[model samples]
Target: MKDVYLFSGFLGSGKTSMLTDVIRQLKEKNLKPAVIMNELGKLPFDSQAVEKDIPLKEMLEGCICCSGAEKTEAQIQSLLLDSDFDVLIIETTGAAHPVEALDAVYSPLFADKLNVKGIVTVADSKLWLHRETLTPQVRSLFMEQIRHAHLLLANKTDLLTEVEQGQVVYELQGLNPHAFILQTTNGRVPLHLLEGLKATTQADKADIVKAPIASLQLGSRLVEFTDVEFSQEQFEDWVRTLPETIYRMKGYVPIEGIKNPMLFQYAYGMVQWLPEYIKMPAKLVIIGENVGSLPVIGMN
Candidate 1:
C-alpha cells in the first residue's frame, strides 16, 4: 500500500513550503513522491512548485470535499495506476475543512489501495493570535484544521515574540492535545517524526464520514488583468478598500514600469509583491465570502 499524507492549512500558512521540504526529504530517502494539488481557481499557481519529474494531478475550480469528490477519487485511481510513487501527498486548498477533505480521500474506490498516514497541518502563529479578525466561518475552519491535525506545525514562529510563541503553543495545545506540536520556521520539521503518525482513530474516522459536510460559504472570483498596468500606490489603495470578508488573493499582476508581471499575494490584511523574472498570466484569484458579489472596480 502507498503511504498518503494530507497537507492542510489556511491560505498563506506555508503549506507549500512544508510540502516542498517534505518532498525533498522523501527524495533524499530514495522514495518516489507524487502530489495532488487542489486549487480554487481555473488557473493553478501552486502546482508550478512541484518538480517536473514528480507525477502530479491538479484539481482546479472547486474544493475536493464538496464539488470535486468524484473527481478526487478518479484522480487518486489514475495516479495509483500511472505512477510508480511510493508516497502520495495531497495539498488541499487553503479554504478546505479537514474533515471534509479526509472524507473525500477515504472513498472506497481507492481507500483499500492506500494507507493514510496522517494529516499535517501548518498553522500560522500570527494568524492564530489574530484569528478574531477572521469571519466566524473561517475562524471555525481554522480551528478545525488544528483540532484534527496529527502533527501540528506552528510555523512562521520567526515572526512572533517569545511570549507570542508561547501563546500560540498554549492555544494550539488546548485545541489538540493529542497532536505532536512543533515550533517551526519556514515549515521546517524532521521527516522522521512523520513516520507511522496517524491522526484519526477508527471511531474518529466513522464520525468524520458520518458528519454533515458543513458549507464554508466561501466563494472565489478570477480577475484577469491581461494588459492592464497599475501603479503601486493605486494597487495599495484598492487593497486597502477591500472588505474584511475578502480573505485570500493571489496571482500575477502587471505593475507600472516593471518589465514583467509581479507575483502578488494577500492574506488577511497583509499584502506582498515579489518580482518575477518570467512573464505569467496576469490573473488573480480572490477567495472569500460572497467574493463574486464584491463591489470592486476593474476586478470584474
Candidate 2:
C-alpha cells in the first residue's frame, strides 16, 4: 500500500522548506515520493521552488479544499495509476482546511491501495500564540488546520525563549491534546518524526468538525513587472507599508542594488528576501482580505 501524507499549514509557516527536507530524507532512504502542490493564485511560485527531479503535480488557481476538489481527486488517481512512487505528499495551500483536503484524498477510487500516513500541520509559533489578534474569519481558518492534525510541528521556535516555546506548546496541547508536538527551527525536523507515522482513519475524520469558510474574506492579486530592477530599500519599504489584511505575498523580484534577483515573500507581517540566481520575469501574487484596491503596479 502507498503512504499518503497531507501537510496542512498556514501561509509562511515553512511548509515548503520542511517538505524539501522531508523529500531529501525519503530519497536517502530509497523511497519514491510524489508531491501535489496546491496554490490559490493563477500563477505558480512554490511549484518552481520544488526540486525538478521529484515527480510533482500542481493544482493551481484554487484551494484543494473547495474549488479544486475534482482536480485533487483526479490528480491523486492519476498519480496512483501512473507513478511508481511508494508515498504521496499533498502540500496544501495555507488557506486550505485539512478535513476537506483529506476528504478528497479518501475518495472511493484509492481507498484500498493507499493509507493516510498522517495529517501533519506546521504552525508558526508566534502567529499561533497570538491568534486572537487575527481577524475572526482568518483565525477560524487557522484553527481549523490545527484541529485535525496528528502531528503539530511548532516551527520557528528559534524566535521564542524557552518559556515561550513551552507556552506555545502548552496552548496547542489545550486545543489538540493528543497531537504530538515537535519544536523546530527553520523547519529542520528530524526524519523519524515524519516517517512511519500512523495513518488517519475514518474515526479520526469523524472527530474533526468541518468549519465554514463563509468568514474567510480572502482575495488575491497577481502583479507583473517588466525585467527591471527595483530599489531594494524602496521595495522593502513598500512591502512593510502593505496593509495588515495582505497576509501572504510571494514571487520573484529583481532588486536594483542587490547583485542577484531575489525571491520575496511576505507573511504574518514579515517580509523576507532570498537571492535568486535564475533569470525570470518579476512578479508576485498577493493574498489577503480587502486587497483588491491595493496600488500594485501592473496588476491582473
Candidate 3:
C-alpha cells in the first residue's frame, strides 16, 4: 500500500505553508514525495511554495465532485504512474470538501497506487470564531474540511490566547471528536501525524441531504453563483440575505481594497476573506442545502 497524504484546509488557512514546510522537512531527511495540488483557479500557490527538489503538479479548474469524481481518478492515476516518489501528498483546494477529496483518492482506479497515510486539516484559530458570518457555502466548506480528518493541525495558535485556543479545539472537537488535533503556527505540523489513516465514509451519492459541500439542511451552492462578478457591496448584500440553513459559502469576488481579487465565505454569520496575494481571474461557487432557488440579484 502506497502512502497518500492530503493537506486540507479553508482558504488562506496556511495549507500551502504547511505543505511547503512538510516537503522541506521530508527532503532534509532525504525522503522524496510527489504532490498533487487541486484548485478551482488557474494559479495554484501550493505547488510553487514547495522547493524545487520535490516533484509536483497542479490540477485546476475543477472540484473533486467532478461529475462523480471520475476526473479526480484520472488525475491521480496519471500522477501515480508518472512519479517515482515514495509518497503522494495531495493538497486540496480551499473549495474542496475533505470527505469528497478522500473519495477521489480511494477510487478503484488507483486503489492499488494509494493508501491514505492520514488526512490533515488546517484550522485557522483566529478566524474560526467569526466563520459563521461568512457565506453559507464558505462555512460548510470549512466544516466539511474538518469533518472526516484523522489528524487536524490547528494552525494560527499565536493569534489566540491559551484559553481561546482551547475554545477553538473544543469547537472543532464538537465537529469531529475522534480526530487527533495538534496546535501550531503557519501550519507547522509534525510528519508523524500523517503516518497512518483510514477513512471508511461510504461514497456520498445522496443528492441533497448527505451532500459533502453544503449544509445538511441549508442547500448551499444550490444558489450556484459561479464565474459571476460581484462587487464588494453586492457581495455584502448577499451576505446579509443568506439563509440560516446555508452552512458554507465561497468563491472569488472583486473587493475594493484588494488588488489580486479575493475569496470569501460565510458561516455562522461570520464572513471570512482571504486576500489573493497573486492576481487571479474571478470565480465563485455557492452551495446551500434544500433552498433549491438560484440566486436572483436586484440592484438597489
What TM-score does each of the candidates earn?
0.67, 0.66, 0.63
Off by over 4 Å in 3: 196-300
Quote the RMSD, in angstroms, for model 3.
14.0
Backbone clash count, each prediction separately: 0, 1, 39
State which candidate has the highest lDDT: 1
Predicted candidate 2 versus true structure: per-residue lDDT over 1-300, tens digit per residue = 888888899999989888888888889999988999999998778888678777899998898978787798789889877878978889999999876676556543345467666678899999988899999999998987886677889999999889999999998888877578899977777778677465432211112212222212333344556655677787887777787867666667777776655787666677788887766546565555444456663222
The number of clashing residue pairs in model 3 is: 39
Q: Could you tell me the lDDT of residue 48 within candidate 1?
A: 93
Better of 1 and 3 by lDDT: 1
Q: How many backbone clashes does candidate 1 have?
A: 0
Find the 10 residues in a row with the least total lDDT in model 3: 199-208
Q: Model 2 clash pairs?
A: 230-256
On the 0 to 100 scale, the lDDT of residue 169 in model 2 is 91
lDDT of 3 by residue, 1-300 (tens): 567787888888998898888887777767888887787877765566766766677777877644435566676777777767877888888887765565556543344345555568898888788887889988888887887666787889998999999999999889987688888998897776566444222121122223242222212222222334567777787778877755444455666556666866554578887787876545333434343443344211
Candidate lDDT scores, in order, read 0.78, 0.74, 0.66
Among these predictions, the greatest TM-score belongs to 1
Give the winner by lDDT: 2 or 3. Answer: 2
